[model samples]
Target: MLRLFLRKYRTMILASVFFFYLGCCLTINFTRIECAFKTSSKNELETRVQSLSKAQYVVIILSSPNNEPKRDAIRATWGNFVNNIFVENGEIINKWNHTRISKQSQQNVVKLLFVVGTLGLSGTKADKLGNEQKRYKDFLILENVEDSYKNLSLKLLNALSWISENLKDMKYVIKCDDDSFVRIDLIVKDLDAFAPSMNAPKLNKFVTFKEHLPTYKGLYWGYFNGHAEVFLTGKWQEKGWFLCDNYLPYALGGGYVISRRIVDYIAQNMDFLSSYNAEDVSMGVWTASLNAINRVHDVRFDTEWKSRGCKDNMLIRHKQTTSDMFQMYKSLAQSNGEKLCNTEELHRKTYFYSWNVLPSSCCKRN
Candidate 1:
């Protein structure tokens, strides 16, 4: 009878005993659930991400004022998944009330926001964008930064700054292009699998990596370009990139992932960071100098200069036209998400980055 009673409350008894030992051994004790959450596995950072600390990930789309059609296409399609927003007849009826994201919603809550620049936006265009922001409440407009290809890096820095100042609770930030089609479900699943390994220490880029290498604490996942040549004078000319013979190896700008610490670092030090011509290149330079960083060169990210065609488990595909987005979304919906894309429709050769090779020879014909 005693054994049966003990067995019935085994977990609670064990927990109480374990915490009692902790209280004796440590200076602080679990007086309340808050302290327990701090010292126990109940409030592990990964646990928070898996359940609800705040939003685990926020997809920040770099957009232009003129890309309303592309934005609408995304909102109505892949970006409109159950995990994302819900818009009705071009207006955000916000089916999910804009309250503090509840613990239930945080399990897979991947929010979406567009980053636009207000350099030349005026009168009708500005008014239209204002109306759109009012309707959707999903835009981060960098008023000082110009919405141009040349200012993309600046745009990115400002966006990170905004995230740090405002939505700082998110664990991961996905910097995606407006044209890219994001696979949110696949990404969330992959991220959960990737979360247990996140145990790195404070991430600061200004602290030069000279002494012992800091054990990697965070993640930077994307398709990285190991070698990219510079243009001294051209449409892509960068007057500020004199750091090395080639630009620092950077993940392609179409879509990439960085942890919150990285975002915080950039946001905190953005005023002093240099803005190169390419936002991705700036990202490389910024993170390359960080205390410690672990990068996953995910081939699943077809975010190179162009798509590596359509693969089975792609996380995000860049250079997608508005039409392409609709078609792909339609196929996924019809197949109940079992079929990602029509293999017959997008027939391009697949390739991988040769990380084993030298930086200059990383990309090869395969």
Candidate 2:
């Protein structure tokens, strides 16, 4: 009887082993089938790329309301700057004001894409345009809010959604405030030289910020005065102000670039927060959470004309008066203080000579 039982047990074990091997074989086959599907999909993508035009186009979305003279003025300012300095002249850079969506002239564009918001749409032209534009599945609008933080947050979320839907075909997306002025020529040249490797996976290149706060419980609040607003709820006691710790890094506002992938990720994950004020900081935290590297490029991110103290030489300047903008552009055109305006040119020359370009080693004391 004992011998018969041992033989039966061995037979059962063999059957179990045979079935496990069969299951493993089936799984391996299915994996290969899935991989083949992916390869075919990749080939399809390659075919599409081969057929499409390969031109680098910069898309600038300037948010403004309708019939505002400022919108036209901003357009003029951008048009003049882009025409004079940028490499891809006429039709290469498409600048669209958010206010003119409803006009008969704008119907074609609104059909393609549209964004709506208070700052984005002002009068009848804008309202009609926005209403019509919203019919499209891709159209996005700013979140309605009475405060600056919520308003800007909604604006950014809308922009991110638009970018994700469009980035596959776009070369670059530049998001700037209405008040910000760009040196398009310099920007194009810089991007041309620094465009991340086409061979490697897409890289996330943008200005990153680091912030550090103290360990003290109550003493740690109320440090950030650069831009801070009150919260609607008292969930947390209103301490002094929260300071971006001296050691902690955080991205600065006024706007920054995001790679297509990063934009896609943000669009899918941006949650509605009640009290977060700094959009740039929020973006930095989000990107870092995804393990994406946030590159801190040395290009001057933001500057005011009046505060041009010693660092007048900057690639980009923000919050400049109209008169100051004229002066700065005129200075660049005239070669006054050659160092300030011609840094990009100088770097190009130095690069051509095969000499090492030194990193900019300067910091503004807050």
Q: Can you write out model 1's per-residue Cα lDDT over 1-366, one digit (the tens) per residue? A: 999999999999999999888877665443565576557633443453333234566888999999999999999887865453323343222232223434343333567879999977778999899789768767777878879998898899988887776664687888899899998766665565444242224222111121233456667877777778887898889887778888877888889889888999999898888888889988999998766576656667788777768865677899999998999888887876767787744456544556566779876645
Q: Please state the error at residue 62 of candidate 1 in Å.
A: 0.5
Error of 1 at 365 (Å): 3.7
List ranges where model 1 is wrong by over 4 Å: 1-53, 82-108, 196-215, 344-350
For candidate 2, what is the TM-score? 0.48
Model 2, 60-166: lDDT tens digits are 34343442343334444543444432222232222322232233222121111123465533467656644544342223334352224345556666666755654
Off by over 4 Å in 2: 1-70, 84-116, 119-149, 197-248, 271-275, 292-294, 303-313, 333-366
Give the Cα error of residue 283 in candidate 1, in Å: 0.3
Candidate 2 local accuracy as lDDT? 0.41
